[model samples]
Target: MSKKQHRGWGVGEQAEQHYLVEPRHLAGGGDVRHVSEFLRAAGWTDQSRTGGPLVFDSPARTVHVAYNPFVRPGGWTITGKANDHEPEWNVTFNPQTPVEIVAGFTDALTKSRSAHAPNPWAPLRQHGWETERAQHFTAVSPDRNAWLQFHQTGEGQAHWWAGARTEHGRTWDAVLTPSTPMHLIEAFSAALADPQPVMRPRGNIPPSRWIRTTSVSVRPSELGAWQQARISAARAATWARNSWASSSPRTHTPTPRPYAAAAGAVRTGR
Candidate 1:
């Protein structure tokens, strides 16, 4: 058999010439406040100090989520700090990333997980992304438009990155620092792997000559149903069942927050 050649670049990868009507997770991540709202729903209190990064605290005030929108690059820096037992970590999302994509990270924040070191790439594989070792455990999205990677130094913490590209070149991306908790990254990976075509405005996306945008004309349409083949598949936490009664999902459901209660404000000595 003759080796397949891609129109643009990479191993067996053809240039993404199809215009994505509703693209992947690059739709300027939704309302910034929605994250705080989700934290509240997951039982974390919003304790942001005036003129400071937005703050969210666990009921006992042991864990804090700090979000600053004014960093040098002009995006959101959401950091999870553990004054108790939760690991201290940081996550960043460029303004162009979709909120749903970011939620893939935040949604994972609620799950109960074990202590064994996590394999963030597993979720990518489960999402049908192909993987290989090339300086890192790299996984390419099924469409070849997006990529996620993970690697660790000798006995050191792991680092992570997720990004999507257009024929024009790289657009939006995220960085998860070593201090970040792994399962959180896992959840994020799952979210990125989801195949659902999110609704996006035509002009909001990059100048792409390769993609075409199509709108949903009906429910249960073949395109809609086919797009959700992997989306409806479940990716709950590793060792525990969902922690609470959540609303029905149009698609992916966040794992349960078994560790905390409603985000009602609680004052405690740190």
Candidate 2:
């Protein structure tokens, strides 16, 4: 059966798949600037789509690019659709990293250790959170070396999604919309065989105002970091050239809302 093109979102000519990555899992410890540069170098053009194939046009070649970030408090979230319709998920350093990060961030945000214990769902659910019902939960577990997995392998509204420790100890998380940390215990428990992973309702999820942190530019000694970024980007370009021999059928269109917040607005999960 052919998957229908989503209302406003575009779809590619070929079948769809999923991909995942974590900036932290890379050689650099999740340096946002470096990651962005690497992806751009990897044949990922900033071009948007209207209603057809999802092809990433870059200097080297055109390919599909789907990426997710794991800077959230709970387990990571995958929230992107690529040209070939592949969902982007990411790898992690360990199996238990999701569970551990989610638990720690949740506690810090809700309990309020200090100003640094910023609320994850602040701007979205400013008033507060309402527990829908009592649910079973597992203990927090965070192993640095793990492969965070994600797939639409579910029936009806339920889906099959999971992340486990990889042999090389690489953990990847998907950065979905309204990016925030998740409670891995809750996420894993939410994934059961029967009904499928309960699909999160579509809505406006905003980030907390307090979560915005700071960053310092690389000093003269930090030039090494830039050098590595260039290398990674070059490698990415090479990967893109080999991945897509032919471009998919695509349509050009504009996206209504660029992201949760505007240019000057505070960006979540930075």
Candidate 3:
């Protein structure tokens, strides 16, 4: 049996070649002209059309864009095939897809056609972060002081937050929404590995106290130490519980004393 290969979102991977755009995430309407314009700008040439889906071919792959007016918001379904004998690719797009998303998808597709490189998020995955779903991930930092979360927004934009645990078991959160540059993502990851104190808004502030001008520079090492302390305390508590549970019952049992007769009763008997 052959292993099923995992492909990135908006990309289709088959035996022969990779299909770049999945229309469902890119197109906004049934009109293929807009999409065609995007393709033409990207160096694709219109091969042929016969009153049906418009066919376009590029050096990398061939594509078919079909209109479906009956679909809600009028959308397009795109199919791609590699020149070599390979599996076909199909994707559907609704009219609700924003133009920016379409543009971003096209840019990504263009890049994929030329050369393949490791995704920017590859490092996060290497360090223990697991993608919970599309554009969302959760991970614990190496220092264990902070729990980090990642979210990718529309137009290739991305954001992340680090939650630092404090001595009182409180969490201090810092959010970073860097520009959608690949280099910036790389720098952010590097910063996490060797965290330094940086001024950030206090995470513990409530809505009422939000006006308070109290900001602090938090360090990754501090958060790690707090996490370690919490672990140590937990271990101590477990040990104490187990020690008490394993001790002999007699050691804790109360002793009973015999009572002497009252002095008055003794005197009367004498």
lDDT for model 3 comes to: 0.38
Tens digit of per-residue lDDT, candidate 1, span 33-91: 54565666566677777887777775555445656666756565667766465667777
TM-score, predicted candidate 2 vs. hidden true structure: 0.25
Models 1 onward score TM values of 0.61, 0.25, 0.29
Model 3 Cα displacement at 103 (Å)?
Answer: 2.7
Q: Model 2 Cα displacement at 172 (Å)?
A: 13
Each prediction's Cα lDDT score?
0.58, 0.28, 0.38
lDDT by residue (139-160, candidate 2, tens digit) is 2122222222222223422222
* Better model by lDDT: candidate 1 vs candidate 3: 1
Task: For residues 39-66, write the lDDT of model 3, one tens digit per residue.
Answer: 5544566664565444566545655544
Instruction: Report how far residue 123 has shifted in candidate 3, in Å.
Output: 11
| Candidate 2 residue spans exceeding 4 A from truth | 1-31, 48-155, 160-233, 236-270
lDDT ranking of the models: 1, 3, 2
Quick one: best TM-score, which candidate? 1
Runs with alpha carbons beyond 4 Å of true place in candidate 3:
1-34, 46-61, 70-73, 82-86, 110-130, 133-270
Worst 10 residues of 1 by lDDT: 261-270
